[model samples]
Target: MAALTLALDAMGGDNGPSIVIEALARALEQFPQHHFIVVGDDAELAELLAAKKLSNHPRVTVKHASQTVEMTDKPGYSLRAKPDSSMRVALDLVANDEAAACVSAGNTGALMTKAYFALKTLPGVLRPALMSAIPQASGKSAFVLDLGANPVCDSDTLFQFGVMGAVAAREVLGIERPRIALLNMGEEDIKGNDVVKSTAQLFQQSQLLNYIGFIEGDDLFADKADVIVCDGFVGNIALKSCEGLADLLLSNIRSNINAHWLTRWFVKLFYHRLQRSWDWLKPDHYNGASLIGLRGVVIKSHGDANTDAFFSAIQQAVEETQQDLPARIRDRVESVLLEQD
Candidate 1:
């Protein structure tokens, strides 16, 4: 196989260079054949690399950019006004085939906007959706799409998401005939709004997808579905709610144990078990979300991602690159769209 080069948007995310630098170092150690082109201001990146003693790595290089698009900046304005921004430069690398993939922990909206405009989409793809995998109960994970990519979507768009998500599950998760479900308010066929009802009907009729009917929010971690499709608005709400509930459960568990000496002793007895369970639920374990249906691979990490999260994002980029996710999704989407035509 050819060498895989990844473009890292160094100026992105809340932690900036620190998290990116750490992730680069860690990834280089794990996958020595992989190379990275860090995009940011030359002088600042150089100083940081020197401080970390990473300037000598053969697999790492820096590409300088003078400006950065802030998280609060409007996606359209940033893409149009700041042509030389790190995010734009990163996309250019993938567009020109200089990089196998691009990863950013920046403004999700801006990154997706830039990617869609610069790289465009597969021939028949109406829109690209962001798909992220979340850990479930059976030592497995579920893929959720439109996780803040297109907040408002029509039935056709949701149907596209289902196809794109199923392709991703097969490629990334190595699942044959991956089970798919639409995110809905009820399990019955006539439960959701018109968009959901229409999309459900489409899935039910389509032979390309393994549509398993409606899945409510509670079924997210039940392992009933391998890929869950929803509009970006509902997907974002589901993701945030899961994270919030995880935090609350962990806190409640800790507080209950600390309330009394006997409880503390019991907690200490089961500390390792508790830690193991909590580790499985941490966001770091599943840190990367791919923007599906684009011409190239673009993985987005959380803005508040730590070093571990950044590292996991890099691993995800490598895995998706190896799986050739973009090509797989393109093929699947083309087939479905052709059938519709």
Candidate 2:
């Protein structure tokens, strides 16, 4: 992947343009092969960039957007009223081919709504799903999807998510012949609702997918499956639960280290090592989720993402662009369809 341009919604995150510009500074240094076009309130973004000494940087350009999408804005309302908003404008740049991808930490619903309209879904794609790689305790990560994109999904939609997730696992994560699994209450042959049963039948019948059996929520990071498929409702709850658990554990560990003298001494001895391990377990480490199956790359960072998390989202967008993920998913879906025919 040679040099490519990426559009950024500079006003999207909770910390405002300051975090975005700071991340851009780091990205510009780290990914010299990429150019950035940041969309936001021009004056504000310019000042922020100037503070980072990126205003005159050759690899970056600032585009003025009159509006900012708020976290509380309704998805439909944001789309209808904020055409020139930073989030919308950033996506428009992708749609017009002025940028290879867009990265935003804006409202997920608003971003998804605009991206569907702006970039459109790929041919043969029913709906774009939010896919993210969750770090596993087993020393490898697995890809999971439908992370709050569609609360209601039919068997066919879930199957399509399986295909998309597998392609992503293979292309993005370099997992060849990725094992795809349905997230269910149990791994038994007769364990789930009608939709899960139907989706299992579909996956089991598909010769292309490495369809493993169902996995319970406890197995999410067990690395038993390369790609876990679920409806958005389940996925969203599961992911947030994992994040919350991670936060709770981190907080407890820090609070407990000094609660016992022996424990305090032990932690002081291995403090650096334990801290390094704990840092990777944080919610912000890999914060971006790709809105896959779109015509262009769109990475949605957590709305309250810090600089590191936002930068991770930018990296996610770049990796997807480099892999030509849309093309891969589109072609794979075409192949699957033709095979069925």
Candidate 3:
């Protein structure tokens, strides 16, 4: 297999180029079959690379970008104003076929705007979706989509998301005939609004999907369904809620364990075991979210991700590119359309 090259928006994330550089160093060691192109201010990125001893590394390359889109910059402004922005340049790398994929922790809207314009959507795809995996009890990840991409989606859009999610689950997660469900207020048929109800009808009617009816908020990680589909507004809130709950639980556990000397000693005795159990729940372990239904692979890393978390995003890019995710999606979508015809 040929070595995959990923373009990184080195100046996009909260910590700027330093964190991206750190991730690059770790990625180079972990994934020997991959190379990277870092885009940012030449002098700053060079200094960070030198400090980390990655400046002379063979697998790393740098592309000088003069401007940067700030975290607060609007998507439209960034698109029109900053032509030389690192995020735009990185996406350009994928568009030009110079890199297999691209990764960024920049403003979500800005990244999406630049990416959609640069790569376009896959054929038969109405729009692109933001899909991420949430760890389930069965040791498999349940795929969810439209996470903040299209806040107000109609029935057709939701159905399209289901198709894309199913293909991704099969190709990337290796699930055979993945069970799909619509996220609703209740498990009953008469639970959600007209949009969800109509989408459910479409899923049930389509032979391409394994439609399993409605799933509630609690079933998200229950492993009851392999894929969950919903509008972006609901999906984004659910994602953020899970992240908040995980943080709260970790903080509460730490505070309780050290509240008393007796409990503190007990916790220390089983610290390793507890830590191993909690590792699965950490957000960093599932840091990458793929913008599916695109012409090329684009991974969105959490803005505040650390070195390890960002590397996980890069791993996602490598795997999806190797799997040729977009081609699989296009094929599945065309099959569905032909079935309808």
Candidate 4:
């Protein structure tokens, strides 16, 4: 395959362009074949690039944008007011085909709004969904959709989430014929509100989906379902809860380990093993969440992500780009629509 060039919204994250430049260095070291277009204030980004010795790299170039979309900026305002922002410019690279994908650690709402306008959704997709690989206890990843994109979805939209989530799980998580389920209050057929129940009926009627049935929120990370479909409201709450829980557990574990000399020694001795085991639950390990169903690839990095977390997001963009995820979703969507027709 040919080289993949990713556009970076260098000023989007909390740490600003420095971290992006640092993460780009790490990415280049690991993926020399992948190139980058760093978008931000030319003078500041150039200084950081020079400090990192990336000033003259053949694989990296900087694009100057006069503005940045702030973390607290309203999505609508950013879309309407910030035409020359770094985030907008980076997204333009993808839409213009100058870059294969774009990565941003900006305002989630703003990024989504800008991306929706710049890239649009695939044919037959009512709206794009946010999908991420939620780590499971079974050493597998559960692909969950609408993590925080569309707050309210109809039955048809939910069904489409299932299809798109399944395709993404298969492509990114390597889950063959991924078993799918809708997130609900209970697993019983009679549970959940009308929209979910109607969606379940649609899934059952479809010959294209591998829909299994309804699954509770607990089933999200239990390996009960490879792909969990829910409206953004529920999925977002679940996602935030999971992340907060993981942090709490890790914090408690670290505190206890440091509370005693004996436990500290044991931790040191088994550091690598424990580290490997706990890495699965770390937020940084799964930092990138794709804006799935878009016409082009867009990976959202956490607004406050560190260098390691941002690097992981870059890796995600590379993997999804290699998989040609947008095209795969488009094809599956067309297939389902044809079947329904």
Candidate 3, residues 1-341, lDDT tens digits: the string is 67999999998988778888988888898889888999999999889999998886898889999999999999999999998999999999999999989999888899999999999998889889999888898888988998988899999889989999998899889999999999999999888899999998888889878999999999998999988999989999988888788778777888888898887989867666777666566543456889999999999998887787788898889889988999999999898888767
List, residue by residue over 1-341, the lDDT tens digit for candidate 2.
59999999999878898888988999999998799999998899888888887778999999999999999999999999999999999999999999999999999999999999999999999999998888788878888999988999999899999999999999888999999999999889889999999999888888998998899998988889999999999999988887788778777887788788888889866767877666566543456889999999999988888888889999888998999999999999988777667
**How far off is residue 108 in model 4, in Å?**
0.6
Q: Global lDDT of each model?
A: 0.88, 0.90, 0.89, 0.90
Query: What would you estimate as the lDDT of candidate 2?
Result: 0.90
Q: Locate the minimum summed-lDDT window of 10 residues in model 2.
A: 278-287
> Worst ten-residue run, lDDT, model 3?
277-286
lDDT head-to-head 3 vs 4, winner: 4
Candidates sorted by lDDT, best first? 2, 4, 3, 1
Candidate 2: residue pairs that collide: none
Q: Model 2 residue 239 lDDT?
A: 85
* Model 4 ranges off by over 4 Å: 258-261, 264-279
Superposition error at 31 for model 2 (Å): 1.8
Off by over 4 Å in 1: 265-276, 282-286
TM-score for each candidate, following the candidate numbering: 0.94, 0.95, 0.95, 0.94
* lDDT string, candidate 1, 1-341, tens digits: 56799999998888887889988989989897889999998888888888889996798989998789899999999998988998899989999999989999988899999999989998788899988887887978889888988999999999989898888888888899999899999999879899999999899888878899999998888999999999999999888877787788888888988998998989867766887777567553347889988988998988888888888888898888988888888888888977777
* Runs with alpha carbons beyond 4 Å of true place in candidate 3: 269-279, 282-285
